[model samples]
Target: MRGTAAADRQSRPGRRALVAADLSMLRGPVSGVVVLPNRLVWAPAPAGRFDLDDPFDRLRVYEIVLREAVHEAELRRWLNGAVLVEVWPHLYLPRGVRQAWEAIHPQLAVVPAR
Candidate 1:
């Protein structure tokens, strides 16, 4: 599925400011989560998939997954065939999810990995 609302929301000023503020929280170039207008983008490998051999080839798949046990089916109708995970919400490690957390709180986010 395409993220039209995501593209549109990025252009707005208030949302842009929020994005900027969120971006500022990052220590350096990283692969984690980005909260856009209506969607969430997760980048697991910020280094751009070092596991790949060809650099130019290989799918830098973000997976757009949710591993949490409870909110699996109830989360989304638009997202089908997406990965799912089960993790304790507040007690989880601070990876890139911190940024996503701010944007989504208890709601599941649609992270767009680049």
Candidate 2:
């Protein structure tokens, strides 16, 4: 998985500016409903209100944060380590975003047993 993700990034012409510096910096809630601010989720769609209890909604929030967040504060505000681990394999992230995160937190690359 790591090899494939890395190869995908290399094939791309330019780097994605959305990649986070590190996952450890995240300090978001592990559960509960969250309404994302407009600044973090504007354009293409309106501000999103997510219910963390629902798997689908949680996935959506994670996807948005990983793709849209521009600052460490935004990342920390919207992401949680435990929740991220649970949803990592299910997240539909860009190659650069996935690779940047999985590179630091290899545990995220380990798919959980079903």
Candidate maximizing TM-score = 2
State residue 78's C-alpha deviation in candidate 1, in Å: 17
- What overall lDDT goes with each candidate model? 0.26, 0.69
Top candidate, metric lDDT: 2
Q: How many backbone clashes does candidate 1 have?
A: 13
In candidate 1, position 85 carries an lDDT of 18
**TM-score, structure 2 vs. true:** 0.73
Model 2 C-alpha lDDT per residue in residues 26-114, reported as the tens digit of each score: 67987788889887567443457778888899999999887766566777788876778778888887777777677756777786734
Query: Residue 33 in candidate 2 has what lDDT?
Result: 81
TM-score of each: 0.17, 0.73
Q: List model 1 lDDT by residue over 13-109, tens digit each.
A: 3331112122212232122333221233334434323222222211122222221211222124212221211122222323443343335333334
